[model samples]
Target: MQPFELVTVKDVPEAIRAQAASETAQQGATVRFIAGGTNLVDYMKLNVETPRQLVDINGLPLNLIEPLPNGGLRIGALARNSEVANNKLVQERYPVLSQALLAGASTQLRNMATTAGNLLQKTRCMYYRDIAYGCNKRQPGTGCSAIDGQNRMLAILGTSEKCIASNPSDQNVALVALEAEIHITGPKGERTVPISRFYLLPGNAPERETLLDPGDLVTAITLPPVPTGAKSLYLKLRDRASYEFALASAAIVVKRQGTRIDHVRIALGGVGAVPWRSLEAEAALHGKEATAANFRAAAEAALRKAHPQTQNGFKIELAKRCLTHALTQAVA
Candidate 1:
């Protein structure tokens, strides 16, 4: 742990200005915004993150969870995970998201974790977390030890030779499936980015994880209303039943008419450097009969681009099965 200065800001602009003072948004960023501190604090304790100053953004009035005029949902960045999961509207309108939230960490963590905090959640790669080991994500160009080392939990999709760390957010996978939009306020004012574009693949510069800039502050997430007859489900496969990250997980949103699939959205977690939204799988299933055969086909299409490492080859099949089962249940 490092001795750092903690400052609490009273407003959004102040918070943004405080972080904008940082030199850069990359791995060695010195300024960081803290809310809930569930994930950030953990890494800080590990000394993987050594921010010289922490800007406390808990006082800002961004905690509202409201329904939009156009039948969508607007979730404030500061809203707690438990609140979003247990909200009546969320449970009824976006059950996949609620289920995904409940499937994460534990009751205590969900209680303390904020929505934006989870949106900006870091990877859980062993090498990245332990400063002793070389990790491209933690310090770019130092070399990715996981590429040829212990990588059972690393990524198989959206992977590069330089990095193979997997995204660990169950909530992010669901958001990608729902086609959610992220609202951010930065030095240049406000901007909206789709959840699909929020996370970046760990290319040569693995230190950069998101599209957010140095002073960019995520304000809220907006979810467009689902189709009339759409059904959604979130399925997670992990080593343990609780307090464990997913080994393979699926978030599926499907609209079926009789026995035929009308529309579908599929996003995978614990397999990609980012939460992977699979247009390939959705295209495979559209206009097809809602049967096990089509579901299996879609799963195969989803993982066709997977590039597995030595120890994590099982993930390709595991993710395929997870997606197939989720699709089967969603349209049933």
Candidate 2:
């Protein structure tokens, strides 16, 4: 690991001041604000992230789970994954979220991982994991080796010729299906970015992962209320159950009548640069009859635009099966 300084702050304001000052004081100094350090520490150990200073923000009171006026939930950034999953309100209202979180990592790691950190976790690409390989995400303009190389865990949507690394978060996939909003704090003040727009695609620059600026902190996440007869589920397919990463997964929220689909929201994981929302599939399902045939057709429509790699062509069919299964469960 690289040599760096550590600064401990008493509050969020002080931590913000320390980060802003560091950027102004040192030209090349890189600073990272740590809360739980579940993801950051792992990356640091892998030498994927080397910061000049580590600002501890665990002092901030950003870990509360408050209920909104609209019968929705507002989850703090510092709220641990396990805490949120076990929260009575969250478990009752957003069972899909709870199931997704529980499916991720282990009980101990989930206790240390925060909502913000989970959302900010980097991709799990093999080339990005190895320091020897040239990855554009690790170092911009260096080039992406996963493009023509072995890429079975890469993306099928929002990918570019430069990078095709998949975003690997089950929680985010559930959040996307639930249509949650992310609240952030920065120098310019506070702003809310919808979970849909919070993550950027690899249009030309895959290095820019999120819409966050320097020293910006995620404050909370809010979920909107849904109508009655709305069913939601998160289905993850992996090599094995417990600790393995997803090969392909689907999060589906469907509002249905007796035998017809009213509204449907679908987001795919392990197959996109971001939590990929399948608008085409959603459109195909809405106002259509809910049947196995329709679900299969929608799944195909969702993956029609997929660009698979040499080793990952199987993902196309795998993802389709997962989506169809998720849709069936949501209807059930």
Candidate 1: RMSD to truth: 0.8
lDDT values, one for every candidate: 0.93, 0.87
Candidate 1 regions exceeding 4 Å error are: none
| Candidate number achieving the greatest lDDT relative to the actual structure | 1
What global local distance difference test value does model 1 have? 0.93
Per-candidate RMSD, Å: 0.8, 1.9
lDDT of 2 at 224: 86
Residue 190's lDDT in candidate 2: 85
- Please identify model 2 stretches exceeding 4 Å from their true place: 21-29
Task: Score residue 130 of candidate 1 by CA lDDT.
Answer: 95
lDDT, candidate 1, 1-332, per-residue tens: 99999999999999999999998765478999999999999999999988999999999999999999999999999999999999999999999999999999999999999999999899999999999998878887789899878999989999998899998999999999999999999999999999888888887787888999999999999999999989999999999999899999999989988889898999999998999999999999999999999999999999999999989999999999999999888877
